[model samples]
Target: MKLLAGAMLSAILLYLVLLLIPGYPPVGEIPFYRDAGFSVIAHRGGRGLVPGNTIEAAENAVDIGSDIVEIDVHMTTDNVLVVRHDAVIDTTTNGSGAIANMELSDIQAYDAGFHEIDYPEASWEIPLTVPSLDSLFTALPNHRYLIELKPTTLPPADALCELILEHQLQNQVVVGSFHSSVLQYFRRSCPSIPTSLGKSEITLFVLLERIKLGHLFNSPGYSIQVPIKYKGFNILTPEFIILAHNLNMRVDVWTINDPKEMKVVSNWGVDGVITDRPDIAISLRERLSFL
Candidate 1:
């Protein structure tokens, strides 16, 4: 009876230990990919505080100690690749019409900064200009960049890849796109640069599918940027981060601006975050000792 009771106790302890352990996919086996120091990537060069994708924004992000400055690229009608968020200039710029429909010379004619207001009733206008990718690279050569390739009518993905290579900026850049075709093209042509797939549709089915098959199709080195909330599961949950880490893939959630949410996500051990408020994110990182 004594021996049987001892055996039962041992079984109970083992069960509790197993329950505490996390679950991950079977193919998730890259040992060296431990969570490094958390990296803060400023989305659209910290759009919350400055004109997005502009030189001023990039400079501000860097000044605040962001690990990387993110920017979007779209080619003009004349095939000049410029940094702007939208395919059209109507929203963020003073200019009108699709960016691809306008020549670089035409785009340069407008005052890109005229429409911007720092605060309501403040009425302070900062002069802004859309910068070429080359100009951005030149301005912040030492800083890393997360370049999102905007799908446009001009300057194909191949041409963009060529420009990156010609500038020898491959090592300092991580290219991403919502278009999987662009990612596939980069995978095939510019294999050296790291790539990430943006998460647009967040569903349980898609998350599970990506977990199971992402490595097979997306290459082993690729990462996924998912939302903090997906299919009723908060991505900042320990289970989610462990699952992603085990898969040899880094998880980056986008547009997370709240300091509390940033703390929660960082505590959960997400590898990185893309935020429009780099200043806020950096402050949160310091407060939480997430760095």
Candidate 2:
């Protein structure tokens, strides 16, 4: 009990130390994490409508008229990049264990749609299995992928780069990682691909934005991807959007599915939105225009 208390106190101290640090923390600084789309990005390949991050979900995103599809990728024990959101396979798949501990074959054998099978809104016609990054690239050559290297773990950046290069998808895909190190390393290996600002970078940018220090907008990544409300604070404002656009950067809000909120952000001139229901967003976009 004493040991647990000591660990908790240490964690609090670390948190306080981080809070006290000023002038851009090391994780926020990405000199080359530099610079996509002005349309909807299907979050987890429209997870609301289909199984998340599977081949079927991606296809559905394209069919639903999502301008771009977003999916999470993780590296397996065999060092192969496969599409799965949660770090552990237990939540989304029939099998249990971390993706890092499971080999490619092991991951493939598990049913990726286990959780969603019982959900009435989800589609079951598509037999869901873990998809390889390579297969996704090949399957949806026409649609762009917003590859999210999840913060749960640092996936193999080099291996991802190799696949991106091999598939000739440098321009067709954009990547983002909340972890600054992953984005930095991936950018170093594949500079042509665009990445979004990390969490630290986003915090700094938001601070600069709120202070009206537009000149201090030195975003490390090509674009800024954020939630509409980060911990109850509405970060997606007109001024922030203007600032990003002024710097030749794009602002995309994630996981927005509400029609009213979509209209609000669209009117604010946000470059894009990441949504679980791309169909709804697409409909909203169409209604916004005067035909």
Candidate 3:
């Protein structure tokens, strides 16, 4: 009994020592994060304001003073990267086919102005064509962007890297993807560009936070962009925000449109809020400044 008791005490001491150890140093400089403050990231270029991922949507988002326009990308049949949120374009556009199966010209031929359910206020009288990432970047040359890669059979890391480098947007864009393999591949192909936490990384982070060992969590990603809550568990706790800031990482919650929720998250000191309503978020930021 005495031997067992001694072993237990030693294990407890080791655990306490580990808890006292400091975490890894801050991650390397994320150019997109440089000089940034309380970013108002437009979700799908402010889908609530207009047809998502279209040129009009992006323009309106910028006009409303959004800090960063978050978009999704999918590769077309002709090896072109287009700004879109899904592999199938049926929902967002009037088209009805997989993006991978259609060429850029084919996809652009269809009307992308199909926000009947989401944005009835936005105009859809004229046809809005889907845009290529190249064109989007050209139109908004100086803007910051958070581009997410939707799942694709063909790996698009090399193509994406080439495009970013070609346009000299290495410092203005951050890549995001749910697939760990995609993010891992992008990191390997283009280490210069910053990325967000992948699925596995987020899981590990939340687990650590739950176990009270969040200080040890480390990754090369520039930020954590999570929903306010996931699967019925609260994620935006005060402790979570403080821990992320302590590690020099920013935490940005997504898809928050309610005015009350916006005020709550902003009060929690999140780095950014990804929302479908850029106008609302930008306005809230103004009010927060006064407070």
Candidate 4:
């Protein structure tokens, strides 16, 4: 009984020490994406009006005045980091293969704009090609990118950091991933780059928030990005925003497109909104002078 008690005490001490550790220091000379206040983030490059994750969609998002363009990164078989949302190309493109098994040249050759079938009114003036991360950065060098790493589909940290360096975009990009390992990899190698809370990290945050004990642990990431609802529970409450801000962390919600819903969260004091319709959100913010 004494031995077991001692082990438990040791575990508790270790956990407490871990909780007090701070997040990695940010890595940019430029203060791009430094603010999280009442901003509009284009989801999948604001895909409702254009094909998702294409350069055209990115251009459209910038033209529409979104504060950030959220793009997913998947490495090709040839080890090129490309802007794509899926591990498999069959759903969003004309081709049929896992992105992990395809070369960059072949993946780029596929008609990425095929998803535009859903939007007949939006003209595909330029060929919608699957853009490499380099291409996307080149297309919108001045804009911010919220790049989600799909390390399970492709190696993310090393390649992603390299690209950020090559493009001088470490400050302009916010790296996030559902997987903790991917975020950890980035944090270790590129601690200066800002990142969102990983899935497990946010899960723990939700639990602590539920019990009103969230202030106990230091945040693992610089920011938190969540959907408005989780398991039907409204997670982006005003109180939740207060808790995050108290910790000096920014809170951003994702995938919100409805104008009414957008207004609701905006009122909740969220730092930003990620949406498939940045145009509508931008207009609403403008009309209300919310920004």
Candidate number of the best lDDT: 3
lDDT of each: 0.70, 0.78, 0.85, 0.80
Full ranking by lDDT: 3, 4, 2, 1
Query: Rank order by TM-score, top first?
Result: 3, 4, 2, 1
Each model's number of backbone clashes?
0, 1, 0, 2
**Against the true structure, what is each candidate's TM-score?**
0.77, 0.83, 0.92, 0.86
lDDT of 1 by residue, 115-226 (tens): 5432112332766778888788888887888788888232456667887787787777777777765666766887766776544322342455544432223233346677
Per-residue error (Å), model 2, residue 102: 0.5
User: Relative to the unseen true structure, what is the C-alpha lDDT of residue 283 in candidate 4, on a scale of 0 to 100?
Assistant: 92
How displaced is residue 65 in candidate 3, in Å?
0.7
Please tell me which model should have the higher TM-score, number 1 or number 3: 3
**Candidate 3 wrongly placed segments (more than 4 Å):** 1-14, 115-123, 152-154
Model 2 ranges with Cα > 4 A deviation: 1-37, 117-120, 123-126, 151-155
C-alpha lDDT of candidate 2 relative to the true structure:
0.78
* Model 3 lDDT tens row, 203-277: 888888887888889876889899978899887788888878877888899989887898888888898989899
Model 1 clash pairs are none
